[model samples]
Target: MTFFTPKKLPKAPLLVVIITLMGAFAPMSIDLYLPAFLQIQEGLATTDSEVKKTLTLFLVGLCIGMMFYGPLSDKYGRRNIILIGATIYSLTSIASTFIANIEGLQALRLIQAIGAGACMVVGRAVIRDVFKGKQVAVMMSVVQVIMMIAPLLAPLVGVMLLYVFDSWRALFWALTFFGSMAFFLTFFFLPETYKKEERPKITIGDTFYNYFLILKDRRSLGAMLGCALPSGITFAYVTGSSYLYQAKYGLTEFEFSILFGLNIVGVIVSALLNIVCLRRFNVLTLIIFGLCWMSISGIVMLLIGGQSLIGFFLSTFLLMCVSGFIGNNIVSQIIELNYDRAGAAMALNSSTQFFVGAIASLLVTHHQELLVPVMGISGILAVIAYAGLYQPWREVRASIEK
Candidate 1:
């Protein structure tokens, strides 16, 4: 039961490594089992649609759970919430392996997402707690690079595990091991970022009210849209990729894994570019740049992605590359504006992202044919939302003078 009480916080590089791994829980959960979609359907004796519901419901739970954990972390402390969440996540993952039916597995996944939500909400709060200004964006990009590793490697690992064990249940075992390690990491290494004196006196009612307050603030709401809407494109791709690659494109499991991994490599490239660009460009500029490119990439995708695999691959790669630039910048803005309410602000930001992702999941699942068009539309709408709502040109001009 050792807890870190370092008078000096861990260095930025080390801290980024720790928090990114913790924050990666949600992505790891989704990506790791992706290659086994067919196996899961067979094992549970369920439809592909039912399996997709597991992903959608998990995202819905993440939305609900983030709203709860964010304010509570503001009231209580980050460390305890993380510990409790990791415990829930680990236990649920273990339970998943033994579930006899798809319904039971879906229930476990929903609960697991709730537990995973704590890590995501609180991890961003920790960054806000420790860093400031462009430093926040820089740190976040570093975090994004580390976090992307989960998806970059997860599918490949899942494919290998499938090859060896020939059972999708082995994937849950790996998750069980990961969740347990996360618990130990939090207990021993993670410091309490939300101190007692700074802790807000939050009530049950205050938690729900906080969401309203955030949405009421136009800048906060706009930055949120800038962050969340692009996520719909991401989820649409994630939800449809397995079906697209394997069923339609006729790629083998290992081949699909490699192609999926390449998209992550695109993200890493953009993230590195984002870190370098932060030295000179304003955060708003980087965000606008990313969104604009994303829209262009999506348009290309809509034009030929449906008919040609190469067109889809190249266009999706470009979209993912630019996407790496958006989240860290937009999140840094949301957090700086709402520093006093970092927990709630991040909760709303993340919850909205996941909610949009849930809707995207449903669309991509039901109408796989429309995946390219949906991606295009989501990208275009994201640009409109940011431009109309946030009005970044004013800030861009301000940054130039500074």
Candidate 2:
């Protein structure tokens, strides 16, 4: 269990599978409740804006929880943190079932998101602790595949739950069940990837010092921002797409779900492409290429004026596929750059991405009538991130490595 002392790679394929499951926690939490949003609003007698705030709160909690879990895991161990977080998540998800008002539901969702965030941040950091470079990229691609499945299936599952129970609360009950299952799996099969002997001493000053060090490292910061801005773009799309599809495009929930699921197929295909590309190219190259594609897709979306479903799907699918590459590569680069403080690096990365996403989502939700502006603004952010963060990061890593 020594940090650098490998132990037969711990059944790598199986380990990858488990890690992918761990990584799916965030997507599951977000997507599972999506189809129920309108139902919940109606049931609670709240406005659309009020219901949207619940999503904002969940993201805020996710950011805060991600910031906390990384240092906690570095101090303790991965398995213990996973168990505690999963338990909290499960209990809070069940509590969500009993909430009567939008305010109460929002509170429970925030707690649930916090637990989900810990799972995601720690899971990524654990992978970094156990794997490196190309192997990490391969594993991340697999994780992307697993993560895509949640969004692909969540709405369908939510729709089915609606048919079965006619109540949105049943979705929370289902999440509780999923959380409980994840808890048992982690408790029994997830080993402590970070050994106590290898862990750095945990102290307030040391934590701040690590944060300062990471902030000072241009490559690390660049890679982090590269991931965060693109993530914000995706979050903007997620926040706005439902309204666009349902109200603007006049699609039914069933149709929208199918379209959403189809868009996720792009992620799966891109992940497969990433796995192949990682063997030949460095992570930074992959990230740049991905961002280029994302930029083009965003531009197309903006130009299309949000008029046609086909145009929307085409642009979004391309963007999501590109995201498959960016997601894993940026994280891989950051983890390599900040290997000594992998936990803190990952925590910071996750927190920043979620924070940016929350802000982007809020902006989109409030000003959704300006669809072009939302897409344009997010697209511009991606372009700035690519030019400012990713390009400079690649050059820096090359100079240092040489």
Candidate 3:
């Protein structure tokens, strides 16, 4: 039942466990320190923008690293890239604790993100490599549910840590511990799902050409953007939630964490529901459903307005609930489009998702009120996403169903 044991060999479930752990690193890195943003700002003697830049840099690092890791993993195989990235990730977390300035912290977070990026992109490729048909869909749902646990509870852990240490530095040390755990797990239990014969040759020109080829495909590119745009609003909320709840609403860290956790819990529930739905519905069908609900959630937020905290909580919860359904389904289809070059496909999906998210988060950080702007943009973006996909939904659906 357990994935991690000294002498136990890896199983199918164990691969899920390892990949899920890898996926959690980014969310945990983001969420665990959310409760400490203000404390970090004060301690490091930095402006709000500077403190926010740490998150932006982390996303940027993910973006850049995804591009690199995808091609490199294709060339080098999954296990070695994961191990190397884990080592880099762990070391950076330790180094992050020692940084005295905001700039150093930002730079180190970016490096940390680069390392963490390997697990996420490569993990997805591994899933595609190992599973087929509805099995892939279900396995992704399972991995998504498990991966989301860190975000669901990380803030609670962060709050508990703050209560004990009363310092932001505690988070980085905790990250170091997390990084080490993931590294050990990957090194010990994860087998190489990518075979040597299938590995792509290492060449810069070929990698860039592949990326260009990917972009030239209208359907794939459209789906990728359609999925990523509304998701940007989710990141906007992530970047702004602490400020929105704690500073604006006067909720304590514990209360804010509880509210924050609600969204993640919603995502988990939605993902599990998606697993049941996937047996009957195709990926594109679930995506359309997700987009519709996301738009509706955004509208609810706009009507509910900023003053209604319960309304904000309910609407935000609804908005996040759709993330799992849309992201996993659309991404699964994308992998199917280029299963042979899965690393590149996943890399493009993740890189664009976070890149767009980082920009949205950065914009939200500058605003005075988090609720209205975050919710408003989310609604508009959802509408835009729906519009983008509406034309191709039927075509994509038929293809996926077949």
Candidate 4:
């Protein structure tokens, strides 16, 4: 845990808007190009494995980059690092548009992800800096609601762009435009949230120590992994959807986008409902509920994801919606920890989730043609998170009773 306290705060609505945009960076970057995978496979002369490498490698870069950016943001400042990171990301997106080879696209996406990772980590830190426990949970749900809209719209956007340009490169160009807008908006509008006077020193040893120490805390690990494991559930659907819908179900690109948007619509509805429910329930209770929903959904998917299209679709929708709840609640628990060390806590919370989620995605991607693995991983991880967090829940209850 850290001792650094926040400085004065900015206006709340504006701050949420900015942070939501930062949060949107990752999903938009990802979902925007998903509809074009088949086209890219043809245009770049790449195999499905190679095309999928772009997704996995981007996640890898995001994981590694966040590990470093968390400590650096704590030492330096959120605004500076975010700007630097977004600039790099925007530049890479632009560069990706011009790359003529699959290897070059893969390399650029990795670097682009490194830059995007800054936004993902620091946005949460900014929230933790200003808001306390319950407020943080509510705000996170609000943020998740706004951010969820990106994926809902992104595939549709990608399809329309593909229709107009008739090329996969159009998606990269769109990313470049968005990235440029983010750079200018952040530069002109965003303020530094972390206080300078109370900042922690930046050192390699201290950073690693802080990271390990957080991991060592059972409660902290519980919260981090609880949020992370569901990510695999979502990513599994994401990585396999084009194949699942197109090859197996015989959906066209336009229809696939509509179906994907329908699932994301579930996420938005859940997030909205979560904002209302947060007023009456504690974070842990909601997390358990979400986990239960995920477990049920996964079991159903395993039993039916391959045989019944409606069953698979409904189960996938449940998994997506539950993800928002689990992540918001888990991160709220992390934010409730030592405020001084909120940056490091958030970093640990984020990087681990990405790392774990990345592995989960990689595993499922390897067997994308199958639904059994997705069901097992998604269902098992939900149960695992619930079991792990139950101890922490008991501890909280004990402390409250005393």
Give per-model TM-scores: 0.96, 0.93, 0.92, 0.94
Best by the lDDT measure: 1
TM-score of 3: 0.92
Question: How well is each residue in 262-298 modelled by candidate 3, as lDDT tens digits?
Answer: 8888889999999989878777778778877877777
* Candidate whose TM-score is highest: 1
lDDT of 1 at 136: 86
Q: Write the per-residue lDDT of candidate 2 for residues 232-284, one digit (tens) a residue.
A: 66777777777788877888778878988887888888888888888897776
Candidate rank order under lDDT: 1, 3, 4, 2
Better of 2 and 4 by lDDT: 4
Name the better of 3 and 4 by lDDT.
Answer: 3
- Per-residue lDDT tens digits for candidate 4, residues 242-279, read 77888778989999999899988888888888888888
Q: Rate the local accuracy (lDDT) of all candidates.
A: 0.87, 0.78, 0.81, 0.79
Q: Write the per-residue lDDT of candidate 1 for residues 255-291, one digit (tens) a residue.
A: 9999999999999999999999998987877898898
lDDT of 3: 0.81
How far off is residue 70 in model 4, in Å?
A: 0.7
Q: Which 10-residue window of candidate 2 scores lowest in summed lDDT? A: 1-10
* Native-referenced Cα lDDT, model 4: 0.79
Q: Select the stronger candidate by lDDT from 1 and 4.
A: 1
